[model samples]
Target chain A: EAGVAQSPRYKIIEKRQSVAFWCNPISGHATLYWYQQILGQGPKLLIQFQNNGVVDDSQLPKDRFSAERLKGVDSTLKIQPAKLEDSAVYLCASSSIKDSYGYTFGSGTRLTVV
Target chain B: SQQGEEDPQALSIQEGENATMNCSYKTSINNLQWYRQNSGRGLVHLILIRSNEREKHSGRLRVTLDTSKKSSSLLITASRAADTASYFCATAALSEKLVFGKGTKLTVNP
Candidate 1:
């Protein structure tokens, strides 16, 4: 089976610029998640989707971050007006309908804001 | 806010030695999971221990959960240089959020 896929392994942008990262999860996986991982820190959940419907996004910075999983398949996360602090690895993960199973993650997109 | 916190933020050991890391959480949880992230790579699930369970093991990895203390520990026996990475403990709280700890950076010297 193929693993989760993310686009633009690395990105560089200036502060206040808009950036978007895309993710394609494993086939038939029902749960998709987006997370931000700062250097030397663990990942922080940004959003979660269950079959195209958002299950949780409490940690998401609504003012600048938005994500969508259309048709319950591939997903995209966008950060507008990026800040210097937003420089981190954007990780995408997927799990089966059964939440008990752990997640499988993609390689992630590393974003650097100047 | 982060729900879990790990102690001994960094650890170094020689190959063939044992490494142990501890994690403590603030609230009740349904399960706790351990993951490893190599440099420049995404996280890989190492093990999962449910709240009702006390211990679990996979290969050289051993995880123990103490619900009463709201803490868990991961022990890597016979450590290898390939095991050099960041180890994180994540809690699946009642709210369905998997909150992660700051992580423990492990360096295994060959």
Candidate 2:
């Protein structure tokens, strides 16, 4: 089984610019999650998708951050007008709906907002 | 918001030594999981202990969960330099959402 895959291992953008990160979850996994990890801190959940429908997005900054998992497979997280504080690692993970034990994570996209 | 809080924020030990990290969380949880993240890499699942189980082990890792105390501990025995990484504890509440702790950065010197 392949691990979760993410693109653009690194990204740099000026403040107020827009950027997007993509993720492809493990095969057959029904749940996907997006998390933001700041320097010197743990990863925090930003959004969660059960198949194609969103199961949680309470922590996502809807005003600037938006994400979608189309066709219940690949997911894209976009940040519009990126802020300096948005410079962090964006991680994507997936797990089996029947097995809630743990998640398999992607390498992540390191975003630098200048 | 983060639910679990890891203690000792950092730890340093020599190879072949044991390193123990602790995590305390608020609210009732259905299960607790441990993850390891190497610098510039994604996290890898280490172990999971359910509310009913008091202890579990995987390879050289040992995890103990005390629901009565709302705390858990991860012990790495005979740790090697390769074990150096950030360790995080995530608590899954009754819901499917998992809340993570700030994490403990461990350094195993060879």
lDDT scores for all predictions?
A: 0.93, 0.94
**Lowest summed lDDT window (length 10), candidate 2 chain B:** B91-100
- Give one digit per residue, the lDDT tens place, for model 2 in A5-54: 99989999999999999999999999899999999999999999999999
For residues B1-110, write the lDDT of model 1, one tens digit per residue.
78889988999999999999999999889899999999999999889899999999999999999999999999999999999999999998654567889999999999
User: In model 2, how large is the Cα lDDT of residue A42?
Assistant: 91
Runs of candidate 1 exceeding 4 Å displacement: none
Q: What is the C-alpha RMSD of each candidate to the true structure, in Å?
A: 1.2, 0.9
